[model samples]
Target: MSEQITKVNSWVLGLTGGIGCGKTAVSNMFEELGITIVDADIIAREVVLPNSKGLKAITAHFGEDILLPDGALNRAELRAKIFTNNNDKEWLNALLHPLIRIKILNDLNNATSPYVVLVAPLLFENNLDKYCDHTLLIDVPTSVQIARTVKRDNTSSEQVKSIIASQMSRADKQQKADDILNNDRSLNLVHIELVDLHKKYLQYALHNKTNSH
Candidate 1:
């Protein structure tokens, strides 16, 4: 699976960050520069849309209680179910990860940008970064991550912290990243940095393309 994705005719830049580390903001900047973003989060939702094979499998295992009135998956109910049950979480992951990965690979293969940004919250955890030409991490302090998540999600601090705890540590992500963008400050500053990084990425993409020929 990983081999097929890595063999695609494009430079893949794997982008990842913690729960509330401004990944959307950064990805939007890349989009404005004409970069294609194959987001795993978006694909995750698409795979489980009403009438999808993923949803059918999930409904079979979890019952109709996991669906909304209109037949859409009740994401909150599924989240709660998996949160308390490790077996259920593993089962769901086993069922969905491959499906999501296949969709992601297809999207990446179809991308027409000079370099494609593959944004995934679980990039490293799922070993998706193995296909990337380079990995970029958006970093912020844990306190900042929790505070931003609480305000944005309207969830309790404890819930935000638990979500953080469930993800790879900031330090571990930092260690694995080929490039890191610290987004704890002003957007103006972040944009300025992103512009520079965009130029760098273009050069890297060009170099890779030339080497491949």
Candidate 2:
């Protein structure tokens, strides 16, 4: 199903990267330049908030064991279940992806900035990049990804590696991306590249707006 059914006035620039590839940092740079960021991760959490339809459906399927005593999702418990069971993982994705996509599209449509950055780690994996006018991949080596994720999340290198394995390969992501920002270097250097990208996106947004009219 197309995530964007209605006309989208704003230019949507999809930003994606592997875990610990500094997607947040890159999105923040765009925000600093007065761009709006529509984050799928944040929307995913919002969809399953206590008493929401998403959570209720999940509870019906997985039972109350999927929720914490405080009524929030027991993410750890759910994660474990999905990890061991491929069917359970597919079930959960089928439930949450549409909800998340709707919210993301709403935010993208409501954005008043020159362009909207739709930041999703699973952009290519879920085909969300198809809706974007352009796709930017934040590139980094697998070793760097594992090291950064391990340090940032206080998780084991093995766990990080497993997560990376689940994602699309770095080479595939690079091949799919319209633009790539190699983030293996210092933030100063990355920022310089981003500044130029920001200008390009602005021009693209303007061009889109003109064409829409």
CA lDDT, every model vs. true structure? 0.93, 0.93
How does model 2 fare in lDDT?
A: 0.93
Locate the minimum summed-lDDT window of 10 residues in model 2. 1-10
Residue pairs clashing, model 1: none
TM-score of each: 0.94, 0.94
lDDT of 2 at 177: 96
Candidate 1: segments with Cα more than 4 A from true spot:
1-6
* lDDT per residue as tens, model 2, 85-131: 99999999988988888888788889999899999999999988877
lDDT of 2 at 105: 79
Output the TM-score of candidate 1: 0.94
